[model samples]
Structures are given as C-alpha cells and as structure tokens.
Target: MENKTKKNAVVLLSGGLDSATCLAIAKSQGFDCYCLSLDYHQRHIAELHAAKNVANVMGAAAHKTANLDLSLFGGSALTDDAIAVPESETAGIPITYVPARNTIMLSLALAWAEVLKSQDIFIGVNALDYSGYPDCRGEYVKAFQAMANLATKSAVEGHAITIHAPLIDMTKAQIVTLGTELGVDYAMTVSCYQADSHGEACGLCDSCRLRREGFAAAGLADPTRYKKHV
Candidate 1:
C-alpha cells in the first residue's frame, strides 16, 4: 500500500447488488475507489446504466466503462441473440455463463490498476448462491490473483496487487444485508440477465430470482422494478 493518506483501488461495478455492495464496502474501508464496468454487449444495456448510477451514487473517485464485443464469440445467452435467456434455473453450469468474462474483466482491471499505480482491485464475485458460475468460486479468484501477481510489473517491483473478493463466501441474503448496511440502494441495481431497456428486471431469470430471494431472506423490501414476468 502507498504511503498516501488514502489507498486507491479499482472496484468492478456490474450495477448489480453484489457489485454495488462491494463498492460500498471498499469505500467504507477508506479506499478511493475507481469503478470499472464492462459493456460486453450483453442482452441489454440496462445493467451498464445501473452500474453508472451505482458508481455515481456511491461517490466513486472515478468511473470507466470499457467496451468489448463478447458477442463475437456468442456462446452464452447474454451475448448471443439466438440463445434465449433461461427463465428457469437449470442444473449444472447455466447457459448464462459467459465464457472468460471475469477473466477478461479482471485482466482489464489489472491493466488499469497498473496504470494508476494502485495495488488493489475489488470484485464482487461470490461462490454461494452464485447460480452455478464456475468463475465465481473462491479458488478461481485466488488463481486470478496469483496470475496477476506474476504477470504485472508492480509485483516484480514488490507492490503486489491484491485482488479483493469481499463477497466470495457470503450468501445472497448476507450480501443483501451487508450492502443495505453500507447504504447501497437496491433499486438502482439491475441484476436481471434480461433487463428491459428501462432497466426493469425480468424477475424470472436466475439472477433476478436470486436477488429477489436475497431481499426476502434479508427481510428487506425489494425495490427492483419488474416487467410482467410469468
């Protein structure tokens, strides 16, 4: 950590509850947060809008959105128009899992952290209640951190970049509770895999279901706007 009065960190803000909550946690820890969101051409741009709102409301020092075309590969429901966003949760890894999404996002974050000469990156990846995404696991985050340490000039110079996954072990309910305590506005986040242009959630997507359930478990009123979902 630098001897500056406040440490600087790059927070990956997805405009979802977890990421927003993660940003709040980082802020609470006294870090000057630089928020990053990715526009990988997902099914809707609503989440990007939510990310922007969260970053602004949280009073981030800066926010940057990087544009990428993950749909060029198009295997996942999010990136491919042909693949429908699954309304029901299926077993195993779901169709919504965009291949190498976190990997690419972290790589980009790592690049920016190096440019900023910061040694901290915060992501909101969780293993429990994570809707079967393999990359959200604890081991995956550790592996990425190890790779980042070996791959960056900062590491060689002894300023090791710490990839922080603050919500990795928390369940959705716990996440919601923590975020609420940190003053994260749930209504501003769009966690739905298929949110409408206005940022209204589909309610039936795995992400939405989990988010809804989280609020329920936390005994909080869900402020998410939803379309007429079956």
Candidate 2:
C-alpha cells in the first residue's frame, strides 16, 4: 500500500503524545515518514523506547536515534540530576526547558531531510496546554523555517524545507481527539518529564498533568501507565 510517489518527511519523534500525533498526521497527509528521535540523556530517557515502538507501529519508512549528551551542557531539570523537576506549575518559563533542544533536534532532522531529498520536517511543539517553552511558539517555528531555507544547500537550489507544527495552536483536548481519530495509540507514547525505567509516568509532573487533563477534557479514558504510588 506504499505510495511510490509519496514525498518523504522527517519527523522529530520524541515518543511523546504530541510527536506521536504529529507522525500520524504526517502519514495521513500521504508522506513517507522518516522518524528521528534523540537520545539526549534526559531524566525520562524511557521515552526513547516509547519513540521506537511508536515509530514501528506507525509504519515509518525508517527511524534513527541520534545519540548525543545534552546533559553536558545542561541548564535544565530534564538533563541535569542536580535540578529537580517541579511537580507544580512555576511562573516565567519553568526550569524544565532544555536550552536550544528543539533547535538542535531540528538541525539534525534537517540534515537527514536534506540527504533524503525531503522538503518537509514535522515537529509537535504546541503553544496551548504546554509548559511555557519559548521554542514551542508559532513565531519561533516560522523563524526557524526561514532560517532553514536560507541555510540549506537544497533550499538554495529551489527546494524549500517546510517546518510543520500541526499542534501549535491546538488545545491538548483537540490534539487527543484528532490523534484518536487518526488511530494513534496514546498509551504507547510517554509525556512524563521524569518517567521511570519501566516507562511508567509520575502523574505529578506538569507534562503528566496536561496529559491527564487532555484525555479528561476529550471524554476519553487516559491510557497512560502511571506508577502505582502516583
């Protein structure tokens, strides 16, 4: 059932709810998806495993994990053991923001996209119902898209890379509903910022709170696996 004429797309698959939905959307759009996940030594590294499973089940043409130690330059709680992931919401951009994470991930995806002759790159960064990560904004995505076009050799040769952020303006409930309609398995994705080794979520984190609320608001039973104590 593969469409030989379908264009290729590089998807930044973080193995989270949003990214998984993004992949399904890309597939639905008739693109041959190439999923890219990062192994950045995050506290919730279990999400990488979730990413692999999600990519496989979603029928990605290929999946790659680019290994890098982002913890070395860690200024955020996710990458540094010294900092604690705040269970409650904090003001003015929480400490969980990884410095230049989306930018770095996009650069890697762009490299593979250029090599694969793909003109599309998909990221599931949402502005609504999200932790206040500045990189998740629509304006940031637009700026990055402009920069990508100017920086890539492929773009200079008339092939422009389009950065897709399908969930940028959507509420979490809307996203969950759309993904469910697209046949995405929400349970297979992990959104916890500090998941355990078995991929069980700590329901107290900001990510978990949003996810839990999303399913509730959508009137769908949340299938996320949380720790027994949570």
TM-score of each model, in listed order: 0.97, 0.97
Residue-wise lDDT of candidate 2 within 63-83, one digit each (tens)? 999998999999999999999
- Global CA lDDT computed for model 2: 0.95
Error of 1 at 193 (Å): 0.5
Per-model lDDT: 0.93, 0.95
User: Per the 3 Å backbone cut-off, how many clashing residue pairs does candidate 2 have?
Assistant: 0
Which residue pairs come into collision in candidate 1? Answer: none
Question: What range of 10 consecutive residues in model 1 has the weakest lDDT sum?
Answer: 1-10
